[model samples]
Target chain A: MIKQFPIQQFLDENGKILNKDIRSQITTELVKNFYQHCVRIRTFDRKAISLQRQGRIGTYAPFEGQEAAQVGSALALQQDDWLFPTYRDHGAAMTFGHSLRNILLFWNGRNEGCIPPEGKKIFPPAIPIATQIPHAAGAAYAEKRKGTKNAAIVYFGDGATSEGDFHEGINFASVMKAPVVLFNQNNGYAISVPINKQMSSQTIAQKALAYDIPGVRIDGNDIFVVYFETLKALERARQGQGPTLIEAVTWRYGAHTTADDPSKYRDQTESQQRRHTMDPLLRIEHFMKNEGMYDEHWINEIEEAAQAEIDLAVQEMEEFPVANPADIFDHVFAEPTWGIQKQKEEYLRLLEVNP
Target chain B: MMNTVIQTKTLTLVQAINEAMDTMLKENEQVILLGEDIGKNGGVFRATDGLQEKYGEDRVLDTPLSEAGFVGAAIGMAVNGFRPVVEIQFLGFIYPAYEQIMTHASRLRMRTMGYYTVPMVIRAPYGAGVRAPEIHCDSTEAIFTHMPGIKVVCPSNPYDAKGLLIAAIEDPDPVLFLEPMRSYRSVRDEVPDGKYIVEIGKGNRLIEGEDVTLISWGAMVPVALKAAEQMKVRGIHCDVLDLRTLYPLDHELIAESVQKTGRTVIVHEAHATGGVGNDIVSIINDTSFLFQKAPVERVTGFDTPVPYFGFEDHYLPTPKRVVHAIEKVMKY
Candidate 1:
């Protein structure tokens, strides 16, 4: 049964196009766009990890190897569509127009990091596992009921498929015909737990069969497949075909977060080997070179530009005004309750007396 | 030259709840209903009877039996500009969805730094005395009140039930509406025909007296009223307060009544260890300690699982127990 859902790929590791049907669809402009975003997010993820190590920011989750999966799926979304991302999917959020400064602020332990830019339908990064799945369904359902073509895309890892919310969310979407795409990045681990320990299912995509929805397993390292498949799924959702689950089979090349040590749970050599042979960036670079679309000067320019942009965001994040302690009580509700009001007053009074 | 009439209907607590949802569904297109068996089945208790027929299946959704799924979905809908009122078949059946409520719905506003608010209500039928089976009669309001960002409202009668349900739906933050199963159809009262909000965080003075303050909410309000009546016969005047909102308890009312009377008895059907009663005690100590005539007395269920229905009567705080507590506080 698992063999039925073999990994689908348009581009192979050697940069050879496996699916000629999409050859006409793939353009030089699309490849460059995917290339720029993949590089931008990878740079950000590595910079975040470095900042965490230097104590410039709090603990950070790195998506160094999963950049293609994040960038491709996010690029497929419409401006009005919703993006529900997990805590580890800031790469996708950034690709979907989330403020880099706010993402940095979030890692720095400030609530201001949670706010998206105005009119961007991006939810705050859901920290709890699989909790955002149902939220995506409901939000998409809202759009559907409003008779709008806007859809939603929710990101999760392979381990999240073990959670009850995953089943519940997909089931609800399937039943209501809610316009949503349950995008799964099979990054092979949930913190320290490996996929084998996570679930017995051979492929996360197969689980969508239970909901009677279309499920596709694809090579997450191939940028073309990830982007085109997600675009197809979003198209289906807009056409009122309900939900589709796309499983991007990929690997995480680093520890789950700065606080973790991946060497404790698994072999570290696999990451080193994958970086040279199976990296998403390398595969895309191979494709660009084979297609004669690669330009060394242009690539250097984008890298320099991405670095400057990220550096400015870092400075802004660091220089933002100190969080007012009163904010803790103020946003608990639209209007503070008497209990919260009293507590806030007492706290402020204590601060004054101490100061 | 105009004639005016304020229409009213005599309804039980559950019927009044239906009317409130009916009114909101008619008034606001954003209002949606979701629960198991809530559509054609009118919910397990019939609180949503005829709502689906009137509003169509899109508005009144009969969801799959997964509480976390629908509740979490409702949270999403609320964030997406929908006012969702979800019905949990029973309060005890809500544990599966507790994570969503605590981690998401309750704190989404604060988590998002006020970028989003969850204007949703969760209605659960709670409490023992109607001989409900295990896990069906747990009155665990304290578990929710311990958290911030969510308001907990429980109504003891038809009038308060109707008004508070409407207010809960209108509230900008998440609200947990606990409907006392025992009091669902136990009594009737004249409910207004249209919309009216019984303000959240305000306690109602059921009866005013000077001897002692009897404080309770939900099904225990009627018990406190009964105790106050019995105390009145013995030349003891009692001030009875029905705290409709449990989370942001009415501090002004609790302090004023406790200070004026100089003695108090708190009643609740929840376990005594960490009940909302403890919070009330803390409030009395904080604000009206100087006026205390005696230590505050509490009449509450024991710190044990609400036993099987055969022993449920023993586990529940009755009017007799409330009267005993008032007497004990008075003697001290």
Candidate 2:
């Protein structure tokens, strides 16, 4: 049953374009867009991990090896579409026009980090697994009812499939014909619990059969495949044909989060070997070289520009306004209830007396 | 009631809720009704009776029996410019969606720093009486009250039901609207027609007196009122307070009433352990402790799960128990 959804790929391990049909469709501008975003997000992820190590930011979730999956799916979204990302999907959010400073602020343990830029339809990173699935469905349903072409894309890990909300959200979307794409990035493990330990199902894509939605599996390391498949899914959603489940099988070369230790559960050597054979960035660079579009200085300029932008974001994040303790009581509701007001007043009085 | 000639109708608590939802649905195009059996079936309690037919399937949705799914989806709809009112068949059945409520719906506003507000309501018929089976009559509003972001509103009568439901639907945050199952059709009041808000976070003093302060809400409000009537006959005037909103309990009313009486008896059907009544005691201690002439007494259900209907009467707080607590506080 799992073999029914064989891993689809446009670029193989050697960066050869296997799909001749999409050859002409892949323009120089399109490949460059993918390449730039992948590099930019990868730079952001690595800098974030380093910040965490330096105690400049709190624990960070890195998408080092999964850059292609995040960049591809995020680039496929329209400007008006909604994006529901998990805590690890900040890379995707950054790719979708979320502010890099705010993303860094979030890692720095500031509430202001949660706020998306003005008019951006990106939701705060959902910390809980699978809970955002139904939220995305509901958002898509709302857009569908309003007679808009806008759709929603929700990203989750492979372990999220075992949750009841995942099934419920997909079932509801299927029944309602909601314009949503359940983007599953199967990164092999949920912390230390590998995919097989979490579910008996061989493939996350196969779970779509239960909800009666079209499910496809793709090589997540291949940026071309991830981009086109997500675009196809989004197009289907916009056409009112209902949701499609796309499983981008990928790997994370780092710990689940800064607090986790991947070395304790999985072989570190395997992750090191995957970098050479199936790195998302290496695959893209391989394709660029094979297409004779790999300019060494141009690529160096992209890397340098990405680093400079990330450094500025880090500085801005550090210089962000100091958090006011009163804000804890203020945002609990639109207007503070009496109890909250009284508590805040008493605390403020205490602060004044003590200070 | 509005001063202008707004029509009034005698309605049961359930009917008042139906009217409230009807009014909101009619007035606001963004008001959406979704829950299991809510559309054609009009809800298990018929609180949403005839709404689907009047509105369309899109407006009044009959959702799958996934509490977490629908509630979470409602939160999404709420953030996306829709005011969703979700009905959980019973309060006990809401545990499946408790994570969504606690982690998402309640915290979304604070988590997003006010960029998004979940203006949604979760209406669950709670409390024991009328012989509901296990887990069907749980009155566990305390679990929600402990959380800060969500407002917990419970109305004891039809008038407050309609007004508070309207207020909750209009409020710019998530509200857990608890409707006592026992009071659903057992009591009737002249519910004012048209739109009105009873005001969240305010307590209503039903029967004012100079004696003991009787604090209660939801199904227990009737029990407290009955006990107050008995005390009145015994030459002890009582102050009966219905705390419409549990999260932000009416501090001023409670302080004023407790200060005047110098004695208090908090009544509720939920378990005595960690119940809202304990919060009332804390409020009295905080604001009116110097005025207190006696230790506060609490009349509540035993710290046990609500029993089956056959044994439910013994498990619920009664007027007799409340009277005993009142007498104990008075004597103390």
Chain A TM-score values, per prediction? 0.99, 0.99
Taking the candidates in order, what DockQ does each have?
A: 0.86, 0.81
Point out where model 1 deviates above 4 Å: B1-3
Per-residue error (Å), model 1, residue B189: 0.5
Local accuracy of candidate 1 as per-residue lDDT tens digits, A1-355: 5798999999999888999999998899999999999989988988899899899999998888999999999999999999999988999999999999999999999989999999999999989899999999999999998999999999999989999999999999999999999999999999988898998888989998889999999999888899999999999999999999999999999998899999999999999999998899898899999989989999999999999999999999989999899999999999998878888999999999995
- Model 1 local distance difference test score: 0.94
Candidate-wise lDDT, in order: 0.94, 0.92
Clashes of each: 0, 1
Alpha-carbon shift of residue A317 in model 1 (angstroms)? 0.7
The CAPRI class of candidate 1 is: high
Error of 2 at B239 (Å): 1.1
Model 1, span B1-332: residue lDDT tens: 26757789999999999999999999999999999999999999999999999999999999998999999999989999899999999999999899999999999899887998899999999999998778999999999999878999999999999999999999999999999989999979999899998998899999999999999999998889888999999999999999999988998999999999999999999999999999999999999999999999999999999999999989999889988888898888
The per-residue C-alpha lDDT of model 1 at residue B174 equals 95
